[model samples]
Target: MDHNHQDPSTGLLTKEFAEGLGQFMAFASNQETTLQMGKMYCPCPICQNRRFGTVRGVWKHLYSRGFMAGYKVWYSHGETDLMVNFGSISQQNNLDEVGEQQGGVDEHIGNVQMVEDRFRVEEPKFEAQIFFDMLDAAKTPLYDGCRDGISPMSSATRMMSIKTDYNLSEDCVDAIADFVKDILPEDNLSPATYYEIHVSGLGLPYQMIDVCIDNCMIYWRRDVVRTSCRFCGKPRFQETRGKSKIPYKIMWYLPITDRLKRLYQSKHTAEAMRWHGEHESNREISHPSDAKAWKHFQSMYPSFAFERRNVYLGLSSDGFNLFGRHRRQYSLWPVIVTPYNLPPSLCMKREFLFLTILVPGPEHPKRSLDVFLQPLIYELKMLWDYGVEVYDIASKENFMMRAVLMWTINDFPAYGMLSG
Candidate 1:
């Protein structure tokens, strides 16, 4: 059989894979093979939704068609690649540049090399040291505007307080920016630009998913294709605050896979994550990783413990009142994903806790937790079944990462909802 050059789950293609497909398609067209345009050309048995806007369509077609169908189509048409083989998923190593077989030992070696080349992403070239160096060079002029020796961060602090804490309008930002510039003329950066620089690579950006106001279902994946809530028939976007414009609710999806990948992206964080394993301690008390439950679980499931780098996460959630001392309080639920891979001292830190899901509400879904947690459940199920491909910074190689939702920590009220 043959394999498609696309990710099975996402149908994402590399530039190299897309270009190769384009060349093969051009070759087939030259040989008088009739090619259909748009979605009509897709050979997938499950779907016919491929569009001709870009290579993404080609990726979708190849992925949906699967190995067997795509192979039959290529072989029957007598299409060939002088430098490639499609007979097997592992054929990336079977042939040399001229499509000829190498030796058995050489094939194994080549396979490993090919896997590394395909998955290994070099560390980002931008160094934090460079950023600090630039800051050091600008420090003198940054503090030059100080009359009575006010700190430079004072201006930034005031700006953040006004924008985030006070929830000021956009028009206020320009005036704040002007005031900050007057104080530090050398660093005359706008508030927006400064914010971008500060948060450029702090964490993985989140995805927004539309959710039903009734807490019945979230419009994600296949559900997203529809305009209205499947369960309640309510419009995906609802009028709120006595206005006819704003969306009623949205679920912010920050996946565990993406968050773990960001940990590997930074050299410092990658090393820091190994502190639990590397620390020298013979005393009875320290980190949660040192506890009996943690050790026993690892002993029971030795496979999970084989890779010390594999992450263990804890789930937590609670409902809180967004408005205090009000006639009608807005109830908001936030689901927090905590990485237990960090040392005990840092594991529970505010900065390390990732807000994976933010359930907006004027009222909490007390008993309807499962319905609202549909998207998270789906992601967890997929992670357990297929796992995620992640780079192992400690080893400087790629590995399949499988994270366990070790435990759930919630209040008594939330416990019943989450457990039920």
Candidate 2:
């Protein structure tokens, strides 16, 4: 089937998009929603009475109803109504008191007012309204002015330049904050905190945890909050100026599932994510999804291909001197995870690279990596077995997303430690 077709005007379906959609539909059929029908079924409201056997069907369903314009209307109004109702309720209480003072509070009048108030207050009780609203508003025009792309000058624009051009330090951020105090009050966010808030605004935030100095384990849940390392029995915090303390190493855990869902929430990224499944077929050396091994794997393990959105990840870790080997002996090991479902061209982009764990080191984790990898491994396994419930912005429905750690990427020098 010639699934790839690009509109001259909108340029919606390129080879990449077609390939991604085809691939997604292939696996989406295995999901519970579609599996029973033995054909791809779109849950979009427009497709309520229709069934399609191709990726084009899925694409059309999402394009037409996925953005949820109706849902957004209801959402914005509902929020406005709630705020209005709050003020109204307060006003009504005062009026009720006034009526009682004036001896105008007949029992029937009181009962009528009470009933009217209940109806007004309970009018916003359309549950699931917010969820649908969020889905509708997520990638809307509101994001364009704030974070879409680099503009000539804006708070976001300046922050981008400061981080890329200048030293990424607390003082640098503070200075920028001072510079833009009138225009945009940063409220003295350290660079780290600023980045955290920035990403969180996009619906992705990272969790930071202290790790064992020996790289033997991470100081995580069920392990004394800030006591000695459970495995090595070494103090979790190091002595500093007087009573001040600092962690020896830190581990950052980034939730993979939510971020993956965010990909679908945004129009551009969501389309780009389907690149792998949307690319032209019957071609050699096009993309990773076109590889023989990928097809063979799909054929061999059909279960893994059940969810088109299920991410296949590649993990990589290596240690490098913090300040060139000669200047300082200190080293840092950053563990990065990448989503391979995106087109190969985009799969390795810095934006798609996720920093899951940061292992501070004077030496490599070697042999101790297993201990530090506990959290990631546990999450991956749970994702594969149980999966996570994620909303589909296009289909206007929720589905389970399962992910797999397809492989690891590391240099020859660090291969032995990270491999097994």
Residues 1-420 of candidate 2 have per-residue lDDT tens digits of 223244558645455644433433333433443445344544344443222333343444443333222322121111235544453233333444433433431223344543443232111112234444544544343223455532222344356566768667756665654555444323322223345324424344577778877876777777737578666689888888877768887866776766776666555675565566546767786766788877777667665564566677888988888888486687678888888888877888898898877766777666777666777888888998988766554544455678877778888877877645
Lowest-lDDT window of 10 residues in candidate 2? 70-79
Give the per-residue lDDT digits (tens) of candidate 1, residues 101-135: 11111212334554443344434224433443444
Candidate 2 C-alpha error for residue 92, in Å: 68
Cα-based lDDT for every prediction: 0.58, 0.57
Off by over 4 Å in 2: 1-179, 182-203, 224-226, 240-245, 278-280
User: How much does candidate 1 score in TM-score?
Assistant: 0.55
Q: How well does each candidate superpose onto the true structure, as a TM-score? A: 0.55, 0.58
